[model samples]
Target: MSHSHSPVSAPATNGHDLAARIAELLTQIDTVKAEYATLDKRANEVAGQLAQRFPVYDELYMSAATEYNRAQADLARTKQADTEPDIPLDDAEKASTPNQAVRSELSGSTHNAPISVNKLYRRIAQLAHPDKTDDSNKHTLFLEAKEAKKQGVLSELIRILALLTGDETRPEQLSQHQGQDALAEKLSRINVLRKELTLYRSQLMQLRNSPMARIVDLISTNTTLSITKAETLYKMTILQRVKELETNTSGIRQDIAFQSNMNKT
Candidate 1:
């Protein structure tokens, strides 16, 4: 009996189709990476500007505001105490006031403390006087320093001096470290962007394995599928993914604007 002839194989064309699709995807990925870099840079710029405008606000805004509020409350309390009649406390009440003698001694001795605390207070005032600087937080620090000196709390004055170190940088000196604040801000934003990039990369991988991407593979492996049909489907999938990336990009821009506005307010 005669041997059966081997089936004739059709021409292989999948290599070119797959190569083209991969190239297209790579191009899109590169574009997205470039855009992400630009966004990261912009975030840094915004942060830097904010840092310059409000150098101490980021670190001490709430604390300074709280201190100011507390001072106001103390003033109100003092005024109320002055308006009330100074009735002598009964023996029972006097016995309950545990620190009355100690407080009396401390108050009496405040005027007799050494001059070192006053010197330290003067040094802090020279460096952190609110009127000497443009920073509003410095005003709060100045007021706190004054109160600490008035109370003769050497430890409190020292603490205030330590905190003033960050505010001691003159505007001219600050110019030397341009973008440092922005760089700090950029780091936080970059972290967020990295997460988004990972998600997008995952999406890209999923898209690569999608039926449309497989169609291109099919065109390469199977002779029945046409190159034109496979390319068209691949492009459609890519376009869809690109649109999604664009939407994500738009949202990111909005977020940046919102953050910038919040800093302004």
Candidate 2:
């Protein structure tokens, strides 16, 4: 028997090769972001259609979803998976209550959070200002800085500042970076794009697995069905969901009641 080993690929060492790779990564990241946006839009459109067809289910579904989210958070807490699910709890919170989500987030993060997200954001903005920086990615960095500021994500602003200046601890060291090597900048840019690609792809996966995505998938998958047949099928599906929700909610309540009674005994 012959033993074989997998070949290892070498990293790009040439300046031109690194620059080309960075350009490619940027394109790929943009494509993934665009795809996620399109999918989200389609799901929202499908949800609106469902609402029009069965207005009554809308209230029931919202209530059921809220209860379901609460239960999930509690379960995750019990299991120590996270404060909620590890990946998308923030997205869920924002979707349900945008204003309250921000307040709650700030409240929870106050311990280690910066004194003021706005002030730190201003510092980052000044450091990465488009007019004061290289033209290649300054505008994009400025936009990301704004978003990080809005989201109260000080760490992200710090990371952006670090990438901008190629120095993690010295955010105001832009002067030293003015004459930085072009290859190093390209490498830093690729690192940023790689992170963005991962984030966008993760979001796409989450969206694909959401309940709203299921509705859009059903519509797309069964488009050949006669309109009346499709309508009937959808109605049945919505009815089943409402029934399941009622059953599950009632079951949870019964479990709690039983537990309380046992505790009293």
Choose the strongest candidate by TM-score: 2
lDDT of 2 at 98: 24
lDDT of 1 at 128: 70
Candidate 1 lDDT, 159-264, residue by residue in tens: 5665577523433343456444443333333333343344445544443444433443545564544655554553454345445535644554555455556556
Backbone clash tally for model 1?
A: 1
Q: After superposition, how far is residue 19 of candidate 1 from its true place, in Å?
A: 42
lDDT of 2 by residue, 84-136 (tens): 22222333322253222221221222122213455555556666666456765
RMSD of 1: 31.7
TM-score of 2: 0.47
Q: State in Å the error of residue 142, model 1.
A: 40
Candidate 1 Cα outliers beyond 4 Å, as residue runs: 1-208, 211-213, 222-224
| TM-scores for candidates 1 onward, in order | 0.22, 0.47
- Lowest summed lDDT window (length 10), candidate 1: 101-110
Candidate 2 residue runs with Cα over 4 Å from true position: 1-11, 65-91, 94-147, 151-180, 209-211, 221-265
Predictions: Cα RMSD each: 31.7, 13.4
Q: Report the C-alpha displacement of residue 10, candidate 2, in angstroms.
A: 11
